[model samples]
Target: MVSKVKIYVSGRGQFAVQVAEALVEARHHVVGVASPRLRDGHSDESQAMSWDRLRAWAYPRNITWTDSSELRAHHIAADVDIILAAHSHAFIGRRTRARARVATIGYHPSLLPLHRGRDAIRWTIRDGDKVTGGTVYHLTEHTDGGPIAAQEHVLVPPGSTAQSLWREHLAPLGIRLLLRVVDDLAGGRRIEVPQDEELATWEPSMDSPPLFKPELIALPGSVSVDSSKWALHGQEGRDHSRPGSTA
Candidate 1:
């Protein structure tokens, strides 16, 4: 078992909120959230204060909230262990990462360095990938490319879509992988796997839809898809127009 640690979280809502809940469940102190009002690409209207909803979901847990933008003004924590981020779209420059007690890790939905950018789940489903999964990795300057600390595989069923898969599968596994990584970091053991260059892939911002790729998707059975979406920020939110990239 690892010693208890003080954690300064970033972002709010599902990804950030769930990770905070899991950390507390694992017996760690969630010192405060570097709560960002906006999730990367969302409009200001959709990014209002959400501590109320967060409290509803995590009522019994004693937690604090701080503006993520004001991170420099706070008192430094004693034994600030590691960082857990997913849709935490704030800038965690090397300065903050270097100050932590453990790894400043992030979670990605696809096996990297393949599908290395956002919209991974969407891309996998669109590309007719029968398999895709989750990974927890150390955060570097790049997006999802980093030392993979731990990963778990998930099978993409035939005819899967981002919306359906997230509701059923991805979200749940994301939380589990986060807990495992937190535990491993707390225990001072980093069992990581470097990404394979040969298998590495990147998602361009303008790629066509999975349904757009008839060869890979239609070979077995053509699965019709809806590739239209409004812009949604936050590292890994589902994009119907495109699958989301990871944090």
Candidate 2:
């Protein structure tokens, strides 16, 4: 039998819950969970698990759960082997990241070096990219700029919406990738791959207006005019986007 690693998770939304549940089911010790309080009573449609549901699940398992606007290093114990950031808005500082025995892993909806910021999915759909995907990488203070551990490409069917793409492809792919990365690490595999800076691209925060305007265009050899547009930063001619791309 393989030894189980101790894990601490930080983030909100269903993705976080899914990671937590998987870790527990795999026999890993879940030390704690740090999540942001749900502002207002509005439920984010993109999230598969609710805060209440997560709390209920954790409490019965005797796990530590914390809900706050920020998750500091003090909130987590020093014995954790890995810190998983799943859809978390707060940045994990160097001090906190150092507490883990291994590196802090983060789940970004878009493939790194492209669509690095928020709303990657919306941008991809708006830009009419033929493919998009997810990545699990080491987290740094520089946003999703850490070295990648794993990535899976997904084809964007014609007329795809941000919600449909996430529900059908990105979310499931992300879960599988995260689990695979954890398994590799636990089995003593060093899988970090540094990203190429020259090919990197990024998007704005979720609060900002979409970086591109949707327009109708005809794909070569196809009679249908698909909705597409040029990205604001002028990083075009590639396949990219995110699961939670809508701000």
Candidate 3:
């Protein structure tokens, strides 16, 4: 039998809510959420579901939540088995991570050891990469440098915008990998693979200017994907427009 763990979520936007919902569906107790302000109503059609949606979903169910600023500014005292970071910009410090019984896991929208930064999806498009993927990794002081828990590659279609790529592929991959990692942890079968630093590449934030020339690096585990079959349709909270920064 698998144990249902207590989890604290750290993130914003639709992706974060999706993570919280998945955890609940998996029978894990979402003890708390540390994200942005929880608005009083649903997000407008133009906007992806924000922290407001999370507020609506969590409050009725009695899931306690606090602002991400608190998590960033000071230590949180939640007695959680794991801290799951999904699309969260705030940093989860060492002291906070130490509170988790298992480990703090984060979802990054790129293959580990590559595109390790705030604007991974943007960099993927700007660099003209044909392949990219998502990673679920243990969180550490190093940015997106934690040891990998799980990873899967996907294809980047020609002329694919960051919004489309993220909504269609990376986001779903992130949800699947995160759940898988959590389940493995609960079942005592969690795996951790150390990343090769030689293969690692870090890019600047979206605010920074684009690189003049693309850097060539060997992608080992990437496989070609038939994007038509993987194409996802309308879903509530899906961000249609390109995001400024996915950090």
Candidate 4:
């Protein structure tokens, strides 16, 4: 695969630095960043630590940071082939979206077309899915129904909480999977299959439901389906046995 390619990162979240670090490890040229302004607005201690980590990590990577609050002419004027989003809640307009020569990939945790909104990892566990995996897909006007480009499956470990599982497991996996997608795209492999709308599911960005975890150690008086515990669902669909097609 091609090495040392130019890439742009969008988002002010922890995932931004994680992807940058991994890409640096793989020797990719991080051109610049156009994330939303960091909320020096109000931050608690844990939030501070995440910010500290982001600061410590990004400094060495030498990424040009743009306060998305400002104009894009500064960062988006550069030549780049890939645009990567980590915790990017904003939609891409023509300017930033046009910078990429190849494609822009949005990374989502749930086997999307399923959980199409925020708190995907938390929602999947809350919903009692037996299997949920990561998906990397082309970004379009819609939330996450875009055609899939590449995906990697990860199982939620046992006795995991929403806070613990995401903070620990899925976050790093997302960065790794996205870099793999970048490598695949760099290889001139642009094969994609349309998502099955019949099985498509959508979750609202707001109004989250009560998370269920099969509370096994509960008292006998309240022994019902452990709605609080998480289980995996829809994993068998990932086993792609089909042959490759040329672009």
Which residue pairs of candidate 3 clash? none
lDDT of 4 at 68: 45
Best by lDDT: 3
For model 2, the superposed segments whose C-alpha errors exceed 4 Å read 39-53, 206-243
Candidate 3 Cα RMSD (Å): 10.0
Candidate 4 lDDT tens digits, 41-67:
545545534343344455565766665
lDDT for each residue of candidate 1 in 1-247, tens digit (9 for 90 to 100): 6877777666555666777878888888877666554444554443344342343344345555555545542333646777666555455666666667677777777776656555777677778888888777887654565679888788987777776776577777877887887877777878777776556665534443222221222222334544354232322211111124332
lDDT of 2 by residue, 17-63 (tens): 77788887888888887765453364773543434444445667788
**Clash counts for all predictions:** 9, 4, 0, 16
Candidate 3's TM-score reads: 0.78
Worst 10 residues of 1 by lDDT: 234-243
Clash pairs, model 1 backbone: 41-233, 118-244, 118-245, 119-243, 119-244, 119-245, 120-244, 122-243, 126-210
- The TM-score of candidate 1 is 0.72
Residue 15 of model 3: what lDDT?
Answer: 81
